[model samples]
Target: MMSTSFLHPCLRRMLSDRGGNFGIMTAIMAPVLLGAAGLAIDYSNMALSQRQLQESTDSAALAAATALASGKVADEAAAKTLAKDFVVGQMTNYAGTASASAIRNATNVDITTSTSSTSKSYSVTVATSYRLGLTPFMNLLGHSTIDISTTSSTTSGTSQTRSALSMELVLDQSGSMGYDTNTCAQYKKNGTTCKTYVVKIDALKQASASLFDALDKADPQHTLVRTGVISYSNGLLRDWTNKVTSVSAMDWGTTKSRDYVTTLSPDGGTDATEPMQLADDTIKKNANSTDAESVAHQKKGNSKVDRFIILMTDGEMTGNSNTWNKDKDQSVRDKCDAAKTDGITLFTVAFMAPDKGKSLLQYCASPGGNYYEAETMEKLVADFESIAQTATKAATLLTN
Candidate 1:
């Protein structure tokens, strides 16, 4: 046992003092806390620089690759030069002139290009060492900067995986299509009495022609699209019966289809069942047949064939006195369901149609945005143009 009573008085007093202990501890830890803060700041700066570098590299790669894919750059040497230029330009935009210059001076950009029979590709790899803004703590730890690198690649060509389109246009030539409209008129002779009637069918013909024009413009070479026409009154017209034609077969320089449309006269009751059935039959035959034109246009291969039917009518479905014996509307609906089940997309247009007609078209169309109703002649044209654009746009497929 040690006795406190025997200790020296001055020594005991010093041991018992605890008033300045906190101040002493703070003084010892101050350097450590400050160093930690400095390291944190330096780490944040490094992270920001790394992100900037990554973004710049990615943008440069995309720009160069797009050019290569589009055939803007002829060969590998040109592509490499283009990629380097893009990187320098992008870095300059990301940082200031001084930083960009420093990065450019330190960086090495390598671009590799390869080509196959069907496609061209470009890959860009950017390597550089980034000089960090050093903190005193980081300097003490012997770390001033880090190296960052990134690689990106892109390819472009006519994709053999893309689907080709085969579209059938089934138009109504019902008596109602001859009704007066404010936008267009046609003259008809009845026993020397020439009557001028503003006709919906005339507007339909013009709009349909515009659609074909758009298709031609989208596919100038006539290699991607094929079309068939079936105009129906009481039944499919004998003149246009099974009149399916490919773009390659048609003379692109002439308006042969449009001219054929101009000769169509509106008569007889509207029966949509026959037209829908005919479209279904045509698409099915095109899909599986060994005929030369069918094999060239619609045959299954590495690519697929997209079958579509565009049904346009201005009146409700009426039972054909010559053919249909059951409920006409129900018969049409049944055929529509069968078409969809067979993977044939349907685009239904009702031009100034009654409620029954609109509802039927809506049901017949492929659900979710396939049905279009045009209240006027102008709208009919716009609808056809929109459909044409959609079909053409969907034909292009981009892959990475």
Candidate 2:
């Protein structure tokens, strides 16, 4: 047996050793445990803040997009106001608070608008941001806050607007058409019973110029009208392609003139397929002549500011006579289909088409409103005027 004093000493030592180990363990675990808890809370808060920020930004972007779609030109003042409303509408103390700051900071807005006499549309973009407050753990980790951002865009177009209009004039020039003396006439009877005469070329130029003069002087409430001409007989004539095909496009800016009419000297073998191809090509090539407007148009399904095709022909597919071959016919049909594919409204005119070609011309135009044939100069001019007026009315109804 041990003496009481020695036993007390050993018992005391054992108790002290146990207490020391417990204290050491507690000291090591206190910071670690606290840090772990802080981390969990901080991460949770971060996630929540991020989700809310996304929602806020999304809503703000949508609001701006809606405004843009409403045809509001994204002028700077309008954009700023749009941003303000978007942010303030969603937050507490919207007009006066940090939420407002967040909203202002978040709003990155862009508005683009294009107008033709027949159509008009706009594009809007809104960007927003939100701040995530730092969690206690983050503070302890020497971080204060995190930021998040988001962006969205929308485009809208409307037709028949009073602001802008797009017009396409198609003219027919074929060699067989040269036998007439008047601007747009064909010999219906011998001199004893002759009516009137107007060569196809002369009549087209006069009608085109007159139409341009009328529309050029007319005013749309807030739109600009643009006209492009496609002169076809054998093949389509664009400035580039038509020039190469010996067709000329006079550069006319008379009365807000943009792109002018293509001049057809009547050289190609007539292929009813030409006008459709040229119209399709021009629409595809120029959504808007300018870049800023082009981007806006692209956003709206690459829609043209306004779309139109005027098919004026004197004869049928006589040249590429083979064009009527099933394969060639299909190809031409495909081109027509492509015009429809491009969302163009086609108009056809038969100045002096033979009975066979007349039927073909009628079939090629928009049913009920597009086919017109004239036998004399007076009729030809009257027909040109009628076609012009009708086309103008229809084009005026398209989006601007």
- Candidate 1 has which clashing residue pairs, if any? none
| Candidate 2 Cα outliers beyond 4 Å, as residue runs | 1-160, 181-197, 219-223, 236-264, 284-304, 320-330, 395-400
* lDDT of all predictions: 0.72, 0.58
Please, what are the lDDT tens digits per residue for candidate 1 over residues 204-235? Answer: 98888988998888666666667767788876
Highest lDDT scorer: 1
Candidate 2 CA-lDDT value:
0.58
Worst 10 residues of 1 by lDDT: 245-254
TM-score against truth, every candidate: 0.61, 0.45
lDDT of 2 by residue, 308-382 (tens): 566666665665452433443345556766776666666666776666567666666666676677766566666
RMSD of 2: 13.4
